[model samples]
Target: MANLLSLFKTSGIFHLTPGMVIMWLISLTLIYLAISKQYEPLLLLPIGFGILVVNLPLADLMKPHEGLIWRFYHYGVQWEVIPPLIFLGIGALTDFGPLLARPGLIFLGAGAQAGVYVTFFAANAMGFSVNESATIGIIGGADGPTTIFLAAKLAPHMLGSCAVAAYSYMALVPIIQPPIMRLLTTREERVIRMKKLRKVGRLEKLLFPIISTIVIILLVPAAAPLMAMFMLGNLFREAKVVERLTNVAQNELLNIVTIFLGISVGATMNADNFLQAKIIFIFCLGLFAFCVSTAAGVLLAKLMNLFLKDKINPLLGAAGVSAVPMAARVVHKVGAQEDKKNYLLMYAMGPNVAGVIGTVIAAGIFSTILK
Candidate 1:
C-alpha cells in the first residue's frame, strides 16, 4: 500500500487540481479559436498547447531551473532576447515607402496611444501598482512582442495573463474594431479618399532607418535594444546587398523565435498564478484599452481633417495600432465597404507601420518612468 501510494502521488492524475482542469479548458478554448476560428493561429496554437502542457500536474515544465519551458522562458523571454529578434523580423518585412509617402499619418500612430496612458490610470485606480498598471496598459498597443517585453520587465508575475490578453485582442481586431470605427465616423468621413502617395526614392528609403535610429534612440535610450534591431533589419532590406540576411531574418529566424516565444509565454500561466480575479480584470482592461485606442485614432483623424486641404479617410486611423497588416487590412476592408473604388491599403500601411514604432516608444517611456 505504501508503494502504491507513492506511485499514485507521482502520477499526474493524482496530483491534478480543479484549477488545472480549468486551465486546460482555457487552453483548449484558445486552441479551438486558433484552429477553427483561425485567430492568430501561428502564435495562439503554440501558446494554447503550451498552456495545456504546463498545467499537467507533475510536468514541472516551468520549474525554475530544471525544466524545458522554464529555460525557454528564462533565456528567450526573461533575458529579452526573443522580442527584439521578433522586431528584427518585422523590420525586414516592413516597407517604409508607405510611411515616408505621407509623414502626417505618423500623428495618428502617436495619437492612438491615448489608450495606453488612459488605461494606466484606470488600472492604477483599481488597485494595481504603477508597474503592473503600465504592463497591463500596454495591451492597448496590440503588439504582442511589446506586451511580452513590457510584462517581463514590469510585472513578471502578470506576464502570462497580460500576453494572452494582448494577443487575444490583437486576434479579434476585426470584430472589436469595426463597431468602434463605424460608431465614431460618418459615412462621408469613411468615404473620403486621399490623393495618391508620391513615390519614395531609394535614397530616402535607405536614409530613413538610419535617421530614425539616431533620432529615436537618442531620445529614449531605453528603447535602443528593440529600436536598433528593428532599424538594422529595415536597413538590411533596403540595402539590397543582403538578400540572404533579409530572407533569413524575416522567415527562418522569425519562425524559430516565434515558436519559443509562444510556448514560453504560455508556460508562464500555470494554475497557481493565473486563476485570480485580477486576471479577469486584465482581460477586461485590455479590451477596453484596445477599443479606446481604436476610437482615439479615428477621432484624431477626423480632427486632423479639419486642418489639411486633402481630407484623409478617417478609417485609415483605425490602423494606428501595432497589429501591422491585420489592422491595416481591416481599415481597407471597412473603407471599401463604403466605397468600393477607394483603395486605402497603402495609405493605411503608413499609420499601421508607424504604430509599431509608436508602441515601442511608449514601452520605452513606461520603462523609463516606472523603473
Candidate 2:
C-alpha cells in the first residue's frame, strides 16, 4: 500500500494541473487552426508544439536552471540572432522595385508608425517601462519579426506574449484591418483610382538597397544589422548572380527559422508569466496600435493627395502596416471592389515592404532611446 502511494505521487497524472491542461488544449487548437483552417502554419505549428512541450507535467521547457526550450531560447532569441536572420529571408523575398518606382510612399510607411509612439506613452501611463511599452506598441505595425527583434532586445521578459500577439494578429490582418480601413476612410476615398506605376529600371532596383542601406544606417546605426541583412538579400536578388542563395534564403531558411521562432515564442507562455492583467492589456494595446497605424496610412495618403496631380487609391494606405503580401493583397481586393480594373497590388507593394523597413527603423529608435 505504501509503495502504491509512492507510485501515485510520482505518476504523471498526479503531476498535471488545470492550467497545464488548459494550455495544452489551447496549443492543440492552434495546431488544428494551422492544419485544417490554414492560419499562419509557418508559425502556428511550431508554437503549438512548443506549447505542448512546455505544458506537459514536469516539463522544464522554461525551467531556467535547466530546460531544452530555455536553452534554445537563450541561444536563438535572447542573443538577438534569429529575428535579424529572418530579416534576411524577408529581404530576399522583397522586390524593392515597387518602392523605388515610388519614393513618396516611404512617408506613408513612416507615418503609420505614429501608433508605435502613441501606444508607448500610453503603456508608460499604465506602469510599463519605456522598453516594455515600446515592445507592446510595435504590435500596431503588424510586422511579426520586427516585434520579436525589438522585444528580444528591449524586454526579453515579454517575448513570448508579445511575439504571439504580434504574429497572431498579423495572421488575422484580414479580420482586423478591414474594419479599421472602413472606419477611417469613406467608400468614395477607397474607390479612388491610382495610375499605373512607372516601369522601374533594373539599375534602379540594384541601386535602391545600396542607397537605402547607406542612408538609413547613417541615420540609425542600431538598425545596421537588420537593415544591412535585408539590403544584402535585395542586392543578391538584383545582382542576378546568386539565384540559388536567394531561393534558399527565401524558402528553406525562412521556414526553418520560422518553426524555431514559433516554438521558442510559445515556450515563453507558461502560466505564471502569461496569465496576467497585462497580457490582456497587451492584446488591447496591440489592436489599438494596428488600428492607429491603418488610420495614419490612410490619412497620410489623403494629405498627399492635396498636392499630387494624380490621386492614389486611399485604400492602399492600409497596406502600410507591413504584413507584406497579405496587406498588399488586401489593398488590391478592396480597390477591386470599386472597379475590378483598378487593381492596386503592385502599387501597394511599395508601402507593404516599406512598412517592414519602417517597423525596423521604429524598433531601432525605441531600442536606442529606451535602452
Clashes of 1: 0
TM-score of 2: 0.96
On residues 278-359, what C-alpha lDDT tens digit does candidate 2 reach at each position?
8889989988888888889888888898888888877778888888889889888877876788878999998888998999
Q: Estimate every model's Cα lDDT from 0 to 1.
A: 0.95, 0.85
lDDT of 2: 0.85
The runs of at least 3 residues in candidate 2 whose Cα sits more than 4 Å from the true structure, single-residue gaps closed, are none
Give, for candidate 1, the lowest lDDT window spanning 10 residues: 220-229
Off by over 4 Å in 1: none
Q: What lDDT, from 0 to 1, does candidate 1 have?
A: 0.95
State how far residue 249 of model 1 sits from its true place (Å).
0.5
**Candidate 1: TM-score?**
0.99
